[model samples]
Target chain A: MIELKNIKKSFDGLEVLKGISMTFEPGKTNLIIGQSGSGKTVLLKCMLGLYSVDSGSMLFGNRPLENMDDNQRRILRREIGMVFQGSALFDSMTVLENVMFPMQMLTDQDEKSIRAAAHEVIDRVNLNEATQKLPAELSGGMQKRVAIARAVVMRPKYLFCDEPNSGLDPKTAIVIDNLIREITKEYNITTVINSHDMNSVMEIGDTILFLKDGLKAWEGNKKQIFKTDNEAINNFVYSSRLMKKVKEVYQ
Target chain B: MKLLHHIGAYLLMLRLVFIKPTKAKVMRKLIFKDIQDLIVGSLGIVAFLSFFVGGVVAIQTALNIESPLIPKSLVGFATRQSVILEFAPTFMCIILAGKVGSFITSSIGTMRVTEQIDALEVMGINSVNYLVFPKLVAMMLLPLVINISMFLGILGGYTATLYGGFSSSADFIDGIQMDFKPFHVFYAFIKTVVFAIVLATIPAYQGYYMKGGALEVGKAATVAFVWTSIVIIVLNYMITQLLLA
Candidate 1:
């Protein structure tokens, strides 16, 4: 599990995360949903240790992330996995090599063992046929699957995905969502996803933290999202007529 | 102030790149990859340019010293001095700043824009060490490229001198042997080693820290080339003054 207490971050005197506090439990798809400027990515980056939080405690389990020394932090990072919004696969490596990279870098495992471990994850993600192909050859959905495979190949304790389904088609997005959700449950990993996709919200958002103007606007599950009385989240989540109609029907 | 900050940042980044090094196994593989990319991959252009430029130096030296009062062997001596002292080490690298420096910047900048560097960082890899240090090691072999340029440059001058009939072969050979200071070769090697480090790091710094979207990758490459060239020229002057003045 990961916990953030009163986490604040700013750049050039412009605050992005405004003392927001939240907790993400294991074995659930924890979604941070907000408008473009509402600090979703910032909060995710802070927890990933990509950005240092200003005046807040980030606890990965009982240990505060900010307190860990550099070596310790690197050790902790090895236990964490992230899927970038762009899918961020090494352009030069084929799918199998990409999946095997973490193990190759961080472990004492022999080539065969690393290959086996990578093969297992690649098989789980159903990328067996595409193992020899480069990232550029894969479609967006396939790329997401590869990213997911790479992220989980090490059996990391925490999984973070930023806008994993942004450019994907609806069916592909839901498929990716369900894949992430399944991986989260299968490994009992603490999974956090940053997104504003409503279809994903309804499909796999086991818990949702909604931010507006750098504040926690609301927190709830997919059902509660439709039923929430918070006007800002409602306005943002149901901006489209179809969603508004869906919300009306739900209400 | 901004320049000072970037310089400080560059120094810090170089420190970070050497700290907490990658696994030797991984680093060895990375070094080989970099050799293939940055050094071996660059042979064709280096050879081609060195040959032609050496010929130019010889021809120009031969043409200008047409006076009967000037010794014919001076053409060969001039060609040897020019190729060894400046053309092979300084001028060729300036050309490579366009070829290799842009490649380093654009490739790394593309990685930055595409979030690949972030991916490495998140995976507990030191992105600088993972990306740049191997290139640094491979570029230590840059003197190898410069060596080839030196040999081919003198050879090209020989070919041109012979074909142009500007001087007797024996006279040119005498000029080649005239006042051959071994210290000059060492000086050129020193310059090559320094430029090699600059080539590996400066463009990497530009690419690693670039902001904005896809369009910015090209801009970063251009900026990297300009900065690398400026630094090389300035350092060349400094080193020449310190060593040969």
Candidate 2:
């Protein structure tokens, strides 16, 4: 489990995360959703330690991440995995090599074992055929799958995905969503995802934290989302024409 | 106050950059990879450069002197001194500033712009240790290798001049023996080592801080070339005055 306690962050006098507190439970997909520039990614980066919160603390399980030295942080990082917004695979390396990188760097396992492990994850992601191909040769969806494969190949205790389904077709997006959700449940890992897509929220949001202007506007599961009376969330969810029509039909 | 803090921050960053890599075993692998990339990868350019430089030095030195007072052997002596003191270290650095320096800057800059460096950090890998250390080692070591190669190439030029009848072999040998100074060679090695550190560090720093996107990476590469060239020329002058004078 991961907990954010009074997490406050600012950039150039603009507060991006205003004393936000939340917990992401293990074995479920925790979603942070907000409109563009509403501080969702900033909050996610803060959680990842990519940004230092101006005030407050972040805990992985019971250990505070804010004060750990680089070595200790690195030890924690070895157990954590992240899928970046851009896939972020090393473009120069083949898919197999990309997936194998973390294990090779962090582990003393021999090459043959690393290769087998990488191939296993590639097969798990259904990307066995594309293992030899570079990232540029893969489709956006395939690249995301490869990213997911790389993230999980080490069997990390925590997984974080940022805009995992961005730029993919709706069908492809759901496929990626289901893949992430299934992996989270299967591995019983603490998983956090950042997204604004309604489809993704509906599909994989076991726990959702909605941010509006750097404040936690609402928090609920997908099942309770539509039933909520929160005005800010209502404006956000119902502002879309398709969702507005769906709400009207349900009404 | 912020400026002072930034300066301190930069110093800390630089310290982290150098220290992290030294502690990791991964630095060895990265260094080997960079050696293969920077030294082995630029073989064609090195070969082409050696051939042209050797030929030009031999021809120019032979043409400039037409006096009986100066032995023809003195041409080879002058060429040897020029090769040891200036041509080998400075010219090789210019080539490297283009080939290896640009490569380090663009590659790391791209990694920065793409957040791959952040990804590495998140994975518990020291981005500097994992990325920059090997390049530093490779850049530092490979120049010495290239300097030796350039020395042999100058010898090849001498041999060519002998075979072409532009200078007699005995005269060439005598000139080399007469003009050779151990300090000149020592100075050349020292300059190459210093050049290696500057060539590796400056570009690596620029790329590590790259912002924007791919265009910014390109800009970093260009800036790396320009800055490294300027540093190399200035340092060459300073070192020459300090060592030779």
Candidate 3:
């Protein structure tokens, strides 16, 4: 589990995360949803230690991340798995090599074992045929699969994905979402996803933290979202006519 | 003030790059690949430029020494001096600042814009050491290339002198043998080593710290080239003053 207490972050004096606090539970898909500039990405980055919080405590399990020394922080980082928004697979490596990279860098495992582990995760993502292909040779959706495979091959304790379904088609988006949710459950990993996609919110958001203007505008599950009385949450969630009509009928 | 900040940051980055590799086998593989990319890939152009420039230096030296007092052997002597002292080491590095430097900047800048560096950081890898240190190791073999350039350059001068009727083969050979100071070769090697470090690190600094997208990658390459050239020229003057002046 990861916990943030009164986390604040700013860039060039423009505060992005304003005293926000949240706890992400293990074995559940924790989703951060907000408008563009609502500090969703910033909050995710702060948790990933990509951005340092201005004044707050970030606890990974029981240990505060900021208090750890450099070496200790790096040791902790090896336990993390992140899927970048752009699917940042190493361009020089094929899919198999990309997936095997973390093991090669951090483990004393033999080559055969590493290859086996990579193959297992590649199969899990249903990308066995694409293992020999370079990232550029694959489609955007395929590349995201490769990224996810690479992130999970090490069996990380924490999984973070930033905009995993942004450019994907609807069907592919849900497939990726369900895949992540399944992985989170199978490994019992603490998973955090930053997304603005409503489909993802409804499909796999076991818990959703909604931010508006750097503040927590609302927080709830998918079912709770539709039934919430908060006007701001209602305005944002029912912005589409179809969603508004569904809400009208349901209410 | 900005310059001081860059210098400070560059020095700090160097400290990170010089750390022990997290995995020796991976580092060895990266170093060998860099040798192919940074050193071996540069051979053809280095040879081509060295030969042609050596020939031009010989021809120009022959044409200018019309004074009856100056010996024909002076053409070969002048060519040897220019090639060994300035052409092979300093000029070749300036060329590399354009060739290898641009490549380093663009590749690394592309990685930065694409979030590959972030990926490395997220994985607990020191991205600078992972990316830049192998290039530094590969470029340490730069003296091998410079030595080849020296041999080809003098040979090119010999050919030009003999064939262009600039001087007799015997006169040119005598000029080559006259006043041979081994220290000059050592001096050139020293300069090549220093320039190699500069070539590896400066462009890396530009790329690693770069911001923005594809267009900015191109811009960073240009900026890296300009800064590398400026540093090389400055070092050329300073080293010459300290060593030979």
- Provide TM-scores for the models: 0.98, 0.92, 0.98
How close is chain A of candidate 3 to the true chain A, as a TM-score?
0.97
Q: Which candidate is the best by DockQ?
A: 1
Which candidate's TM-score is highest? 1
Instruction: Give model 2's DockQ, 2 decimals.
Output: 0.57
TM-score of predicted chain A against the true chain A, for each candidate:
0.98, 0.98, 0.97
Candidate 3 true-interface contact recovery: 0.94
Off by over 4 Å in 1: none
The TM-score obtained by model 1 is 0.98
Q: Each prediction's interface RMSD?
A: 0.8, 2.1, 0.9
- Ranking the candidates on lDDT from highest down gives 3, 1, 2
Off by over 4 Å in 2: A109-116, B1-14, B21-26, B66-68, B152-166
Docking class of 1: high
Candidate numbers sorted by TM-score from highest down: 1, 3, 2
> Model 2 lDDT vs. the true structure?
0.85
- The interface root mean square deviation of candidate 2 comes to 2.1
Q: lDDT per residue, candidate 2, A37-143, as tens digits?
A: 89999998888888889999999989999989978887888889899989999988999989999998888888899999999989988998999999999999999
Alpha carbon deviation, residue A106, candidate 3 (Å): 0.9
How close is each model in CA RMSD to the real structure?
Answer: 1.0, 2.7, 1.2
lDDT of 1 by residue, B23-92 (tens): 8998999999989999998899999989988888989999998579999999889999999999989988
